[model samples]
Target: MPSHERFRTRREKMLGQLRELFLAEGFASFSIGDLAERFRCSRSTLYAVAPSKEQIVVATVRSYFKTGAERIEARVAASADPAQQLAIYLESVASELQPASATFFADLADFGPANEVYQENTQYAARRVQDLVTQGVKVGVLRPVHASFVGAAVAEVMGSIQRGAIQEATGLDSAQAYRHLADLVMTSLADPKKPAHERRAT
Candidate 1:
């Protein structure tokens, strides 16, 4: 491989290990030297991916969520029904977030760059939900609630969840909180007269 490809390959390999560590222990609990030791590599190797510990954390967070977005998109595309597509999207997100601890999310919320990735992801999801709502309403599966209002509400709830407010109030971790959020959105949008299978949870 070329030199740059070799470097990219090595960085990705190290980041895979780092992602697992962050999920297991939370990013706030580790330092550069700590990560180096955990990976059984020199501090220089860690620095190869990022100039400092903070940047490494940001990079790891980006990588985790980027992969998550791909998975969610794939699952959403697999379904033909709007409600099923929305449910699959939300469930995929919940699964991706199942490993996040309170501390991990707390750190993510406080960090600017890392938080932006999360915010973008949430916005994209909200847009998707809005589109699904529009589709379902047209198809008579969802009630004629304002799609924009519901989309914005879901985004607000997601913002609260990212900031730990939801977890603080409900004692739900990120994954559980997202599941409840999905349920709320689906229940609110589902047309009562629709078939039971259409309203069933994913």
Candidate 2:
């Protein structure tokens, strides 16, 4: 393999371990020294992938969300049924975020750069969601409401959920909150002509 590809492969391997650690223990507690000791790698090896601890955190979070968006979009495009696509896309989002802990998100909110990465992803997500809703409306699977309004509202709620507001309002954790949100949105947006059983199953 080429040197760059080899390096990227190594970095992705290391990032998998780091992402698990961050999700389980939170990002605020670990330092480069701690990471090196925990992962059984030298400081130079860690530095080769991420020059600093904050950069590592940002990169890990970005990777997690980026891959999640890709999977959700692919699922959305997999079917011709608009109702099914909506269900799959939203439910996929909940599944993707189910592993994150409160502490992991709290740290992201406090870290400006990492938080910006999140914001950018959320903006992209909003656009994707809007497009899906528009398609649904065009096909008559969803009600004719303003697509921008629905998309923006859902994205705002998701942002609040990430910031731990959902946990504060309800005793549910982030993952549970996402599941509930997906259910609620799907129920409201699902085509009335579709059988209830089908919508629920989707």
Candidate 3:
């Protein structure tokens, strides 16, 4: 049984440790020496996988968005209506990211992600929006808006929902904002005149 233990590569172990540190403290401006202390490994070991702190930060943010996209995808699949699917996807994404403090967001306020990992995750999310919008347009659920425009609009709303909702709440917290976001998305995307097949084709 000793030799039958589950297998994991050194790279996987390093990634896991990196994830663990992220969960415990969130994003920090840590040097290789700092990560070395956290992982109890040589600085060379940390640098072996992530050569720079920027790489590590980008990797962590990529992980965040990838996890968020997966959550939204699940929500979309579970919903019966295209409208509802778009709403659920938006609300769920906001719900997932609401815990991330605004400090990191403020720091990277204008910094567009340059890493391919983050870009790929973003494209995946965008494709989901495209599907939702195209379905809405096909079904007459939403008005005849360009799918690209609608997708971009939904993406913006999803990012802005936390701020929008929080400002409206007295003591309601973020849950109310997410709920409001879902409702608004449904209102915007639902096309009652079109059939499921036509929309699905989209």
Candidate 4:
């Protein structure tokens, strides 16, 4: 007689539990054993989805970027003005960075090392931003700057705003930092619907 299986749909259940755990714990100090125990599975079961702990962390980061990209797309779709859409998109990113874990940040600190999956996800996020800028430019809704340059500038400004926000949500620095940077970046990227001064006044 063949042995019976105790856990049907195990992979889905495990992955679901993994997502939940990631959201709750924010990807700090995680391991396959913890996931296995959470899902009541053997450690070997984790190897099926991820080869190492770093792979699991990278996957979690990828998951975050993927969901974040979806939200940005939805926000962009709902907005009319290309400038407003870009501002909203950038500000949304600054806001989103607040909930990320320190461990996630630490993992990212090592991202420049020779890590394929990690690098891939980071590049994917950057490419998404560049692609959006490229589309806006092609449609004549954005300035003709290089997409890569604009994307890098956007990332840098957003990071600055996020760091400033992390300090305290008071004073003009916190309340208006990201907004101000968004205005600067978007004004430069906006279409020729209005004069530069008028767009800046916005």
Candidate achieving the largest TM-score = 2
lDDT of 2 by residue, 83-146 (tens): 6787787788778777877788788889998889888877777677788789889988887879
- Worst 10-residue lDDT window, candidate 2: 193-202
Better of 3 and 4 by TM-score: 3
Model 4 over residues 19-118: C-alpha lDDT tens digits? 5566456454656667777777788777655677666656655556566668867877786655556666666755555555544444454554313444
Please write out the lDDT profile of model 3 over residues 1-202, one tens digit for every residue.
Answer: 3433322255456766765565445555667788888778887666655667777666666656666677767767886677667666656755775665444543333335523443454456557777877886687567677898766765564445333434444443344555565566555555556665443312
Error of 4 at 139 (Å): 6.8
* Per-prediction TM-score to the true structure, in the order listed: 0.90, 0.93, 0.61, 0.57
C-alpha positional error of residue 191 in candidate 4 after TM-score superposition, expressed in Å: 7.8
The reply for model 4, stretches above 4 Å from the true place, is: 1-13, 23-28, 39-45, 111-149, 155-183, 187-202
- Ranking of all candidate structures by their lDDT, best first: 1, 2, 3, 4
Write out the backbone clash pairs for model 3. 140-191, 141-190, 141-191
> In model 4, what are the clashing residue pairs, if there are any?
none
- Count clashes in each candidate, considering only residues at least 3 apart in sequence or on different chains: 0, 0, 3, 0
lDDT of 1 by residue, 1-202 (tens): 9999999999999888888888777787788878877888999889987999888988888898888889888888887888777777777788999987777777778778888988888888788888888887878777888888888888889888887888889899889988888887777777788776768545
lDDT by candidate, in order shown: 0.83, 0.82, 0.59, 0.59
Prediction 4 global C-alpha lDDT: 0.59
